[model samples]
Target: MEPNPDREPGIPTDLLGVARIAGQSLRHIVGAVTKGAVHTATDLVDDIRSGEPISQIFDERVDLFRRAALSALGLTSTETGVPVETKVDAEDLKAMGDAMITEGWDSAQQPRELHPSFVPILHDLTPDEARILRFLAVAGPQPAIDIRTKAPFGIGSQRLADGINMIAAMAGCALPDRDHHYLGNLSRLGLVRFSTEPVADFRRYAFLEAQPPAQAAYRSVKMRAISSYRSIYLTVFGKQFCDACFVLGDYTGGGWAGDDRGDIYLGKGPRLP
Candidate 1:
Protein backbone atom coordinates (compact mmCIF):
# COMPACT_ATOMS: atom_id res chain seq x y z
CA MET A 1 0.00 0.00 0.00
CA GLU A 2 1.05 3.62 -0.49
CA PRO A 3 2.36 5.53 2.47
CA ASN A 4 -0.32 7.41 4.35
CA PRO A 5 0.45 11.09 4.22
CA ASP A 6 -0.98 11.67 7.68
CA ARG A 7 0.81 8.84 9.50
CA GLU A 8 4.43 8.58 10.56
CA PRO A 9 6.77 5.82 9.35
CA GLY A 10 6.21 2.43 11.07
CA ILE A 11 2.97 3.74 12.55
CA PRO A 12 0.01 1.37 12.97
CA THR A 13 -3.02 3.50 12.26
CA ASP A 14 -4.79 1.70 9.45
CA LEU A 15 -8.38 0.48 9.52
CA LEU A 16 -7.29 -3.21 9.65
CA GLY A 17 -5.27 -2.74 12.85
CA VAL A 18 -1.88 -2.13 11.29
CA ALA A 19 0.83 -4.28 9.73
CA ARG A 20 0.27 -7.33 11.92
CA ILE A 21 -3.00 -8.08 10.17
CA ALA A 22 -1.12 -8.55 6.90
CA GLY A 23 -0.03 -12.02 8.03
CA GLN A 24 -3.62 -13.20 8.28
CA SER A 25 -5.20 -11.10 5.58
CA LEU A 26 -2.73 -12.08 2.91
CA ARG A 27 -2.41 -15.83 3.48
CA HIS A 28 -4.87 -16.60 0.71
CA ILE A 29 -3.12 -14.11 -1.53
CA VAL A 30 0.19 -15.91 -1.16
CA GLY A 31 -1.44 -19.30 -1.51
CA ALA A 32 -3.08 -18.26 -4.73
CA VAL A 33 0.16 -17.03 -6.19
CA THR A 34 2.15 -20.12 -5.21
CA LYS A 35 -0.74 -22.52 -5.85
CA GLY A 36 0.89 -25.17 -3.63
CA ALA A 37 3.81 -25.48 -6.01
CA VAL A 38 7.14 -26.31 -4.39
CA HIS A 39 10.78 -26.26 -5.32
CA THR A 40 12.82 -29.37 -6.10
CA ALA A 41 13.32 -31.93 -3.35
CA THR A 42 17.11 -31.55 -3.70
CA ASP A 43 16.89 -27.81 -3.11
CA LEU A 44 14.71 -28.38 -0.02
CA VAL A 45 17.27 -30.90 1.29
CA ASP A 46 20.09 -28.40 0.68
CA ASP A 47 18.28 -25.72 2.69
CA ILE A 48 17.83 -28.17 5.56
CA ARG A 49 21.47 -29.15 5.38
CA SER A 50 22.47 -25.48 5.58
CA GLY A 51 20.46 -25.27 8.86
CA GLU A 52 18.40 -22.30 7.60
CA PRO A 53 15.27 -22.14 9.74
CA ILE A 54 12.24 -22.87 7.55
CA SER A 55 10.14 -20.77 9.89
CA GLN A 56 12.46 -17.82 9.28
CA ILE A 57 12.11 -18.35 5.54
CA PHE A 58 8.32 -18.32 5.89
CA ASP A 59 8.45 -15.06 7.86
CA GLU A 60 10.48 -13.48 5.07
CA ARG A 61 7.98 -14.74 2.52
CA VAL A 62 5.16 -13.22 4.53
CA ASP A 63 6.59 -9.78 3.81
CA LEU A 64 6.54 -10.57 0.12
CA PHE A 65 3.00 -11.87 0.49
CA ARG A 66 1.83 -8.62 2.08
CA ARG A 67 3.31 -6.55 -0.71
CA ALA A 68 1.72 -8.75 -3.37
CA ALA A 69 -1.64 -8.47 -1.65
CA LEU A 70 -1.42 -4.70 -1.55
CA SER A 71 -0.51 -4.56 -5.23
CA ALA A 72 -3.44 -6.84 -6.15
CA LEU A 73 -5.68 -4.51 -4.18
CA GLY A 74 -4.55 -1.67 -6.46
CA LEU A 75 -2.63 0.14 -3.73
CA THR A 76 0.64 1.78 -4.66
CA SER A 77 3.79 0.13 -3.37
CA THR A 78 7.48 0.16 -4.17
CA GLU A 79 9.20 -2.67 -5.99
CA THR A 80 11.02 -3.61 -2.80
CA GLY A 81 8.00 -3.88 -0.49
CA VAL A 82 5.05 -2.15 1.20
CA PRO A 83 5.91 1.26 2.62
CA VAL A 84 6.26 1.41 6.36
CA GLU A 85 3.47 4.00 6.69
CA THR A 86 1.04 2.51 4.18
CA LYS A 87 -2.59 2.60 5.15
CA VAL A 88 -5.72 0.97 3.73
CA ASP A 89 -9.36 1.72 4.46
CA ALA A 90 -11.83 -0.84 5.80
CA GLU A 91 -14.03 -0.68 2.72
CA ASP A 92 -11.05 -1.38 0.45
CA LEU A 93 -9.92 -4.26 2.61
CA LYS A 94 -13.40 -5.74 2.53
CA ALA A 95 -13.50 -5.47 -1.23
CA MET A 96 -10.10 -7.13 -1.44
CA GLY A 97 -11.25 -10.00 0.74
CA ASP A 98 -14.32 -10.48 -1.41
CA ALA A 99 -12.18 -10.60 -4.49
CA MET A 100 -9.82 -13.08 -2.92
CA ILE A 101 -12.66 -15.49 -2.14
CA THR A 102 -14.28 -15.15 -5.54
CA GLU A 103 -11.06 -15.64 -7.45
CA GLY A 104 -8.87 -17.77 -5.19
CA TRP A 105 -10.65 -20.29 -2.99
CA ASP A 106 -14.00 -22.06 -2.91
CA SER A 107 -16.21 -23.39 -0.08
CA ALA A 108 -14.86 -26.97 -0.09
CA GLN A 109 -11.26 -25.89 0.42
CA GLN A 110 -10.76 -26.87 -3.22
CA PRO A 111 -8.77 -24.75 -5.59
CA ARG A 112 -11.05 -22.98 -8.03
CA GLU A 113 -10.13 -21.23 -11.23
CA LEU A 114 -7.98 -18.27 -10.37
CA HIS A 115 -8.47 -14.92 -12.07
CA PRO A 116 -5.71 -12.58 -11.04
CA SER A 117 -7.05 -9.89 -13.38
CA PHE A 118 -10.23 -9.53 -11.37
CA VAL A 119 -8.28 -8.38 -8.34
CA PRO A 120 -7.54 -4.93 -9.71
CA ILE A 121 -11.09 -4.64 -10.99
CA LEU A 122 -12.41 -5.20 -7.47
CA HIS A 123 -9.75 -3.08 -5.84
CA ASP A 124 -10.30 0.00 -7.98
CA LEU A 125 -14.07 0.10 -7.57
CA THR A 126 -16.07 1.72 -4.78
CA PRO A 127 -18.76 -0.43 -3.19
CA ASP A 128 -21.44 1.45 -5.12
CA GLU A 129 -19.55 1.00 -8.36
CA ALA A 130 -19.09 -2.70 -7.71
CA ARG A 131 -22.82 -3.00 -7.02
CA ILE A 132 -23.54 -1.44 -10.39
CA LEU A 133 -21.33 -4.04 -12.08
CA ARG A 134 -23.04 -6.86 -10.25
CA PHE A 135 -26.41 -5.44 -11.31
CA LEU A 136 -25.30 -5.28 -14.92
CA ALA A 137 -23.98 -8.85 -14.70
CA VAL A 138 -27.52 -10.15 -14.36
CA ALA A 139 -29.53 -7.27 -15.79
CA GLY A 140 -27.50 -7.40 -19.04
CA PRO A 141 -27.03 -4.29 -21.18
CA GLN A 142 -29.58 -1.57 -20.52
CA PRO A 143 -30.38 1.62 -22.39
CA ALA A 144 -29.08 4.79 -20.84
CA ILE A 145 -32.44 6.51 -21.38
CA ASP A 146 -34.36 3.72 -19.66
CA ILE A 147 -31.99 3.89 -16.72
CA ARG A 148 -33.05 7.53 -16.30
CA THR A 149 -36.69 6.98 -17.24
CA LYS A 150 -38.63 3.75 -16.68
CA ALA A 151 -36.69 2.23 -13.78
CA PRO A 152 -37.85 3.13 -10.28
CA PHE A 153 -34.52 4.63 -9.35
CA GLY A 154 -34.28 6.07 -12.86
CA ILE A 155 -36.64 8.94 -12.09
CA GLY A 156 -35.04 12.40 -12.17
CA SER A 157 -36.19 13.12 -8.61
CA GLN A 158 -34.14 10.14 -7.40
CA ARG A 159 -30.93 11.82 -8.47
CA LEU A 160 -31.14 14.05 -5.42
CA ALA A 161 -28.83 13.07 -2.56
CA ASP A 162 -31.73 12.51 -0.23
CA GLY A 163 -33.55 10.45 -2.83
CA ILE A 164 -30.51 8.31 -3.43
CA ASN A 165 -30.08 7.83 0.29
CA MET A 166 -33.73 6.79 0.54
CA ILE A 167 -33.23 4.22 -2.20
CA ALA A 168 -30.20 2.95 -0.36
CA ALA A 169 -32.24 2.65 2.80
CA MET A 170 -34.60 0.21 1.10
CA ALA A 171 -32.09 -1.59 -1.11
CA GLY A 172 -29.45 -1.90 1.65
CA CYS A 173 -26.76 -0.60 -0.67
CA ALA A 174 -25.86 2.89 -1.79
CA LEU A 175 -26.25 3.85 -5.46
CA PRO A 176 -24.82 6.71 -7.43
CA ASP A 177 -26.79 9.91 -6.87
CA ARG A 178 -26.41 10.80 -10.53
CA ASP A 179 -26.83 8.02 -13.07
CA HIS A 180 -24.72 9.71 -15.74
CA HIS A 181 -21.80 10.13 -13.36
CA TYR A 182 -22.11 6.51 -12.30
CA LEU A 183 -22.02 5.37 -15.92
CA GLY A 184 -19.06 7.61 -16.53
CA ASN A 185 -17.18 5.96 -13.70
CA LEU A 186 -17.95 2.54 -15.16
CA SER A 187 -16.71 3.78 -18.53
CA ARG A 188 -13.50 4.92 -16.89
CA LEU A 189 -13.08 1.36 -15.59
CA GLY A 190 -13.43 0.12 -19.20
CA LEU A 191 -16.26 -2.14 -18.08
CA VAL A 192 -19.11 -0.26 -19.76
CA ARG A 193 -19.43 1.73 -22.97
CA PHE A 194 -22.04 4.10 -24.34
CA SER A 195 -23.15 5.30 -27.80
CA THR A 196 -25.70 7.86 -28.95
CA GLU A 197 -26.48 6.12 -32.24
CA PRO A 198 -27.33 2.50 -33.09
CA VAL A 199 -23.78 1.52 -33.96
CA ALA A 200 -23.30 -1.80 -35.78
CA ASP A 201 -20.58 -3.07 -33.46
CA PHE A 202 -23.15 -3.20 -30.66
CA ARG A 203 -26.21 -3.58 -32.87
CA ARG A 204 -27.04 -6.96 -31.35
CA TYR A 205 -27.52 -5.35 -27.95
CA ALA A 206 -30.84 -3.81 -26.95
CA PHE A 207 -31.73 -0.27 -27.99
CA LEU A 208 -33.73 2.11 -25.86
CA GLU A 209 -36.39 4.35 -27.34
CA ALA A 210 -36.58 7.67 -25.57
CA GLN A 211 -39.99 8.18 -24.05
CA PRO A 212 -41.80 11.22 -25.55
CA PRO A 213 -42.75 12.46 -22.07
CA ALA A 214 -39.15 12.19 -20.86
CA GLN A 215 -37.90 13.96 -24.00
CA ALA A 216 -40.42 16.73 -23.38
CA ALA A 217 -39.24 17.08 -19.79
CA TYR A 218 -35.61 17.32 -20.98
CA ARG A 219 -36.58 19.95 -23.59
CA SER A 220 -38.35 22.00 -20.91
CA VAL A 221 -35.07 22.02 -19.04
CA LYS A 222 -33.20 22.63 -22.31
CA MET A 223 -31.20 19.40 -22.10
CA ARG A 224 -29.29 18.51 -25.26
CA ALA A 225 -30.81 15.72 -27.36
CA ILE A 226 -27.45 14.00 -27.71
CA SER A 227 -27.15 13.72 -23.93
CA SER A 228 -30.78 12.70 -23.52
CA TYR A 229 -30.56 9.29 -25.28
CA ARG A 230 -27.89 6.60 -25.36
CA SER A 231 -27.21 2.90 -25.64
CA ILE A 232 -25.12 1.38 -22.86
CA TYR A 233 -23.29 -1.92 -23.31
CA LEU A 234 -20.73 -3.87 -21.33
CA THR A 235 -17.34 -4.43 -22.90
CA VAL A 236 -15.74 -7.86 -23.04
CA PHE A 237 -13.60 -7.00 -20.06
CA GLY A 238 -16.73 -6.10 -18.14
CA LYS A 239 -18.34 -9.45 -18.89
CA GLN A 240 -15.22 -11.35 -17.82
CA PHE A 241 -15.18 -9.38 -14.58
CA CYS A 242 -18.81 -10.21 -13.83
CA ASP A 243 -18.21 -13.87 -14.67
CA ALA A 244 -15.20 -14.18 -12.39
CA CYS A 245 -16.51 -12.05 -9.52
CA PHE A 246 -20.27 -12.51 -9.56
CA VAL A 247 -22.92 -15.21 -9.84
CA LEU A 248 -24.86 -14.85 -13.10
CA GLY A 249 -27.17 -17.84 -12.56
CA ASP A 250 -28.72 -19.00 -15.87
CA TYR A 251 -28.11 -15.85 -17.87
CA THR A 252 -25.62 -16.85 -20.58
CA GLY A 253 -25.17 -17.58 -24.30
CA GLY A 254 -23.80 -14.35 -25.79
CA GLY A 255 -25.89 -12.16 -23.50
CA TRP A 256 -23.13 -10.38 -21.64
CA ALA A 257 -20.29 -11.84 -23.69
CA GLY A 258 -21.31 -10.64 -27.11
CA ASP A 259 -17.94 -10.56 -28.92
CA ASP A 260 -14.31 -9.90 -28.35
CA ARG A 261 -13.73 -6.27 -27.49
CA GLY A 262 -10.00 -6.92 -26.99
CA ASP A 263 -8.58 -4.61 -24.31
CA ILE A 264 -10.77 -1.58 -23.64
CA TYR A 265 -8.98 1.57 -22.60
CA LEU A 266 -10.23 4.75 -21.01
CA GLY A 267 -12.40 6.84 -23.42
CA LYS A 268 -11.76 4.41 -26.31
CA GLY A 269 -14.43 2.03 -27.59
CA PRO A 270 -14.85 -0.63 -30.26
CA ARG A 271 -15.54 0.41 -33.87
CA LEU A 272 -19.25 0.66 -34.66
CA PRO A 273 -21.06 -0.91 -37.61
Candidate 2:
Protein backbone atom coordinates (compact mmCIF):
# COMPACT_ATOMS: atom_id res chain seq x y z
CA MET A 1 0.00 0.00 0.00
CA GLU A 2 1.35 3.47 -0.95
CA PRO A 3 0.38 6.78 0.76
CA ASN A 4 -0.71 9.58 -1.65
CA PRO A 5 2.01 12.28 -1.82
CA ASP A 6 -0.58 15.11 -1.54
CA ARG A 7 -2.96 13.57 1.05
CA GLU A 8 -3.06 11.98 4.50
CA PRO A 9 -5.31 9.32 6.07
CA GLY A 10 -8.38 10.52 8.04
CA ILE A 11 -7.60 14.11 7.00
CA PRO A 12 -8.46 16.16 3.91
CA THR A 13 -5.61 17.60 1.81
CA ASP A 14 -7.52 20.49 0.16
CA LEU A 15 -9.04 23.37 2.16
CA LEU A 16 -12.41 22.92 0.43
CA GLY A 17 -12.32 19.26 1.36
CA VAL A 18 -11.59 20.28 4.95
CA ALA A 19 -14.44 22.84 4.92
CA ARG A 20 -16.86 20.31 3.44
CA ILE A 21 -16.01 17.74 6.08
CA ALA A 22 -16.20 20.37 8.84
CA GLY A 23 -19.56 21.63 7.54
CA GLN A 24 -20.90 18.10 7.53
CA SER A 25 -19.50 17.55 11.03
CA LEU A 26 -21.05 20.79 12.28
CA ARG A 27 -24.47 20.00 10.81
CA HIS A 28 -24.21 16.63 12.52
CA ILE A 29 -22.29 17.92 15.52
CA VAL A 30 -21.98 15.25 18.21
CA GLY A 31 -22.24 16.42 21.85
CA ALA A 32 -21.18 20.04 21.05
CA VAL A 33 -17.44 19.82 20.21
CA THR A 34 -17.29 23.67 20.13
CA LYS A 35 -17.76 25.74 16.94
CA GLY A 36 -15.34 27.16 14.29
CA ALA A 37 -13.51 23.86 13.86
CA VAL A 38 -13.08 24.27 10.09
CA HIS A 39 -10.74 27.27 10.16
CA THR A 40 -8.66 25.50 12.83
CA ALA A 41 -8.44 22.42 10.62
CA THR A 42 -7.21 24.44 7.63
CA ASP A 43 -4.66 26.43 9.65
CA LEU A 44 -3.45 23.22 11.30
CA VAL A 45 -2.95 21.61 7.90
CA ASP A 46 -0.65 24.49 6.98
CA ASP A 47 1.19 24.22 10.30
CA ILE A 48 1.70 20.44 9.76
CA ARG A 49 3.15 21.14 6.28
CA SER A 50 5.45 23.78 7.88
CA GLY A 51 7.18 21.05 10.01
CA GLU A 52 5.33 21.87 13.31
CA PRO A 53 4.71 19.03 15.79
CA ILE A 54 2.57 16.45 13.95
CA SER A 55 1.39 15.24 17.37
CA GLN A 56 -0.02 18.74 18.03
CA ILE A 57 -2.44 18.16 15.14
CA PHE A 58 -3.57 14.88 16.71
CA ASP A 59 -3.77 16.30 20.27
CA GLU A 60 -5.83 19.38 19.32
CA ARG A 61 -8.08 17.40 16.94
CA VAL A 62 -7.81 20.29 14.51
CA ASP A 63 -8.34 22.91 17.26
CA LEU A 64 -11.20 21.03 18.92
CA PHE A 65 -9.60 21.00 22.40
CA ARG A 66 -8.68 24.71 22.20
CA ARG A 67 -12.22 25.68 21.19
CA ALA A 68 -13.87 23.37 23.71
CA ALA A 69 -11.62 24.68 26.46
CA LEU A 70 -12.41 28.30 25.57
CA SER A 71 -16.13 27.54 25.46
CA ALA A 72 -15.96 25.80 28.84
CA LEU A 73 -14.30 28.90 30.30
CA GLY A 74 -17.22 31.06 28.97
CA LEU A 75 -15.16 32.71 26.21
CA THR A 76 -17.27 33.51 23.17
CA SER A 77 -16.28 33.85 19.51
CA THR A 78 -15.20 37.50 19.27
CA GLU A 79 -12.06 36.54 17.31
CA THR A 80 -13.60 34.23 14.67
CA GLY A 81 -17.34 34.84 15.26
CA VAL A 82 -18.21 31.13 15.43
CA PRO A 83 -19.16 30.41 19.02
CA VAL A 84 -20.75 27.64 21.07
CA GLU A 85 -22.10 26.96 24.56
CA THR A 86 -21.56 23.88 26.69
CA LYS A 87 -24.32 22.49 28.90
CA VAL A 88 -24.04 24.06 32.35
CA ASP A 89 -25.13 22.58 35.67
CA ALA A 90 -26.69 24.02 38.88
CA GLU A 91 -23.24 24.74 40.27
CA ASP A 92 -22.46 26.71 37.14
CA LEU A 93 -25.60 28.80 37.73
CA LYS A 94 -24.60 29.50 41.32
CA ALA A 95 -21.08 30.45 40.28
CA MET A 96 -22.36 32.82 37.59
CA GLY A 97 -24.69 34.56 40.04
CA ASP A 98 -21.88 34.88 42.63
CA ALA A 99 -19.54 36.26 39.98
CA MET A 100 -22.20 38.83 38.97
CA ILE A 101 -22.48 39.99 42.62
CA THR A 102 -18.73 40.36 42.85
CA GLU A 103 -18.69 42.34 39.65
CA GLY A 104 -21.40 44.62 41.06
CA TRP A 105 -19.26 45.37 44.13
CA ASP A 106 -16.22 46.42 42.07
CA SER A 107 -16.02 50.24 42.25
CA ALA A 108 -13.22 50.64 39.73
CA GLN A 109 -15.45 50.61 36.65
CA GLN A 110 -19.02 51.89 36.20
CA PRO A 111 -21.00 48.67 35.82
CA ARG A 112 -24.45 48.68 34.29
CA GLU A 113 -26.70 48.33 37.31
CA LEU A 114 -29.67 47.09 35.33
CA HIS A 115 -31.25 43.97 36.77
CA PRO A 116 -30.31 40.70 35.06
CA SER A 117 -34.00 39.82 34.66
CA PHE A 118 -34.57 42.92 32.46
CA VAL A 119 -33.14 41.15 29.41
CA PRO A 120 -35.65 38.28 29.52
CA ILE A 121 -38.43 40.70 30.42
CA LEU A 122 -37.75 42.63 27.22
CA HIS A 123 -38.09 39.40 25.22
CA ASP A 124 -41.43 38.67 26.92
CA LEU A 125 -42.95 42.10 26.10
CA THR A 126 -45.07 42.81 23.05
CA PRO A 127 -44.61 46.02 21.07
CA ASP A 128 -48.00 47.24 22.19
CA GLU A 129 -47.14 46.51 25.80
CA ALA A 130 -43.87 48.39 25.34
CA ARG A 131 -45.74 51.36 23.96
CA ILE A 132 -48.11 51.21 26.88
CA LEU A 133 -45.19 51.13 29.31
CA ARG A 134 -43.54 54.07 27.59
CA PHE A 135 -46.78 56.01 27.78
CA LEU A 136 -47.34 55.13 31.42
CA ALA A 137 -43.77 56.06 32.19
CA VAL A 138 -44.44 59.62 31.04
CA ALA A 139 -48.20 60.02 31.32
CA GLY A 140 -48.17 59.06 34.98
CA PRO A 141 -51.11 57.24 36.51
CA GLN A 142 -53.99 57.22 34.08
CA PRO A 143 -57.45 56.65 35.46
CA ALA A 144 -58.99 53.19 35.30
CA ILE A 145 -62.09 51.75 36.86
CA ASP A 146 -64.44 48.81 37.21
CA ILE A 147 -67.95 49.68 36.08
CA ARG A 148 -70.59 48.09 38.26
CA THR A 149 -74.35 48.40 38.76
CA LYS A 150 -75.38 48.99 42.33
CA ALA A 151 -78.12 46.75 43.71
CA PRO A 152 -80.75 47.94 46.21
CA PHE A 153 -79.27 45.66 48.89
CA GLY A 154 -75.71 46.13 47.51
CA ILE A 155 -75.29 42.34 47.64
CA GLY A 156 -76.03 41.52 43.97
CA SER A 157 -74.00 44.24 42.27
CA GLN A 158 -72.78 43.14 38.85
CA ARG A 159 -69.56 44.29 37.17
CA LEU A 160 -70.38 45.74 33.72
CA ALA A 161 -66.75 46.32 32.63
CA ASP A 162 -63.53 45.51 34.44
CA GLY A 163 -60.18 47.34 34.34
CA ILE A 164 -61.15 49.89 31.72
CA ASN A 165 -58.59 52.60 30.91
CA MET A 166 -57.51 55.05 28.16
CA ILE A 167 -54.02 53.55 27.88
CA ALA A 168 -54.62 52.09 24.42
CA ALA A 169 -55.64 55.39 22.83
CA MET A 170 -53.14 57.42 24.82
CA ALA A 171 -50.24 55.10 24.20
CA GLY A 172 -50.97 55.12 20.45
CA CYS A 173 -51.02 51.35 20.48
CA ALA A 174 -51.48 49.75 17.05
CA LEU A 175 -54.07 47.28 18.28
CA PRO A 176 -56.26 49.21 20.68
CA ASP A 177 -58.58 46.19 20.79
CA ARG A 178 -55.95 44.11 22.59
CA ASP A 179 -55.31 46.76 25.24
CA HIS A 180 -56.67 44.64 28.04
CA HIS A 181 -54.60 41.65 27.01
CA TYR A 182 -51.47 43.82 26.78
CA LEU A 183 -52.15 45.31 30.21
CA GLY A 184 -52.57 41.80 31.58
CA ASN A 185 -49.20 40.77 30.18
CA LEU A 186 -47.50 43.92 31.58
CA SER A 187 -49.07 43.25 34.97
CA ARG A 188 -47.87 39.66 34.76
CA LEU A 189 -44.36 40.95 34.14
CA GLY A 190 -44.66 43.35 37.14
CA LEU A 191 -44.34 46.36 34.84
CA VAL A 192 -47.70 47.97 35.55
CA ARG A 193 -50.47 47.68 38.11
CA PHE A 194 -53.85 49.04 39.14
CA SER A 195 -53.49 50.93 42.38
CA THR A 196 -56.20 50.55 45.01
CA GLU A 197 -56.25 54.32 45.46
CA PRO A 198 -57.00 56.84 42.69
CA VAL A 199 -54.88 59.70 41.37
CA ALA A 200 -54.79 63.14 43.06
CA ASP A 201 -56.64 64.81 40.21
CA PHE A 202 -60.18 63.40 40.48
CA ARG A 203 -61.02 65.21 37.22
CA ARG A 204 -59.08 62.51 35.32
CA TYR A 205 -61.76 59.96 36.25
CA ALA A 206 -64.46 62.05 34.52
CA PHE A 207 -62.54 61.84 31.23
CA LEU A 208 -61.90 58.09 31.64
CA GLU A 209 -65.50 57.44 32.70
CA ALA A 210 -66.61 59.24 29.54
CA GLN A 211 -64.63 56.86 27.35
CA PRO A 212 -66.58 54.48 25.07
CA PRO A 213 -65.90 51.33 27.09
CA ALA A 214 -67.26 53.00 30.21
CA GLN A 215 -70.24 54.45 28.34
CA ALA A 216 -71.08 51.08 26.81
CA ALA A 217 -70.88 49.47 30.19
CA TYR A 218 -73.24 52.13 31.48
CA ARG A 219 -75.62 51.70 28.52
CA SER A 220 -75.82 47.94 29.14
CA VAL A 221 -77.00 48.54 32.70
CA LYS A 222 -80.54 49.71 33.49
CA MET A 223 -79.09 50.86 36.86
CA ARG A 224 -76.81 53.80 37.63
CA ALA A 225 -73.10 53.40 36.74
CA ILE A 226 -71.01 52.85 39.86
CA SER A 227 -67.43 53.67 38.95
CA SER A 228 -64.85 51.90 41.10
CA TYR A 229 -61.98 54.28 40.30
CA ARG A 230 -58.32 53.37 40.37
CA SER A 231 -55.14 54.50 38.62
CA ILE A 232 -52.71 52.43 36.55
CA TYR A 233 -49.03 53.31 36.88
CA LEU A 234 -45.60 51.70 36.62
CA THR A 235 -44.07 50.00 39.64
CA VAL A 236 -40.63 51.28 40.79
CA PHE A 237 -39.07 48.30 39.07
CA GLY A 238 -41.01 49.14 35.95
CA LYS A 239 -39.95 52.80 36.15
CA GLN A 240 -36.31 51.69 36.31
CA PHE A 241 -36.82 49.49 33.27
CA CYS A 242 -38.49 52.28 31.30
CA ASP A 243 -35.70 54.70 32.28
CA ALA A 244 -33.06 52.34 30.96
CA CYS A 245 -34.87 51.20 27.80
CA PHE A 246 -37.29 53.87 26.52
CA VAL A 247 -36.77 57.36 25.08
CA LEU A 248 -39.33 59.50 26.82
CA GLY A 249 -40.18 63.20 26.58
CA ASP A 250 -40.39 65.66 29.45
CA TYR A 251 -43.97 66.74 28.90
CA THR A 252 -44.59 68.00 32.40
CA GLY A 253 -42.84 71.23 33.34
CA GLY A 254 -41.93 69.97 36.81
CA GLY A 255 -38.18 70.05 36.04
CA TRP A 256 -37.34 66.66 37.61
CA ALA A 257 -34.28 66.06 35.46
CA GLY A 258 -30.91 67.85 35.52
CA ASP A 259 -30.62 67.93 31.75
CA ASP A 260 -33.12 68.49 28.91
CA ARG A 261 -32.89 64.84 27.87
CA GLY A 262 -36.06 63.48 29.53
CA ASP A 263 -37.94 63.92 32.75
CA ILE A 264 -38.65 61.12 35.19
CA TYR A 265 -42.41 60.97 34.75
CA LEU A 266 -43.67 60.02 38.12
CA GLY A 267 -46.55 62.46 38.27
CA LYS A 268 -48.12 63.88 41.39
CA GLY A 269 -49.87 60.63 42.27
CA PRO A 270 -50.14 58.47 45.36
CA ARG A 271 -47.42 55.85 45.78
CA LEU A 272 -48.37 52.26 44.98
CA PRO A 273 -48.48 49.50 47.59
Q: Report the C-alpha lDDT of model 1 over 1-273, residue by residue, as the tens digit.
A: 443353333423322322243333323433322212212222333453588754444433433443444444444444443443346566656655665555444354333454444665576677766666666666455444422322344444321111011111111246544555666777888998775643344332222234343445445533332223345667888888877887667544333334455654344456553
lDDT of 2 by residue, 1-273 (tens): 234443334443333333333332221122122233334534554675698765444543544634443343343344333443446766654554554344335353232556645766887888988888888887677788889898777688998898888788777789998988999999899988888688765656778788888899999967686988888889998999998888776543133122244324344654333
Per-model C-alpha lDDT, please?
Answer: 0.46, 0.63
Give me the displacement of residue 100 in model 1, in angstroms: 23
Best by lDDT: 2
Question: Which pairs of residues collide in candidate 2?
Answer: none
Give the distance in Å from residue 216's predicted Cα in candidate 2 to where it truly belongs.
Answer: 1.7
lDDT of 2: 0.63
Superposed by TM-score, candidate 2 places the C-alpha of residue 131 at a distance from the truth, in angstroms, of: 1.1
Cα misplacement distance, residue 56 of candidate 1 (Å): 3.3
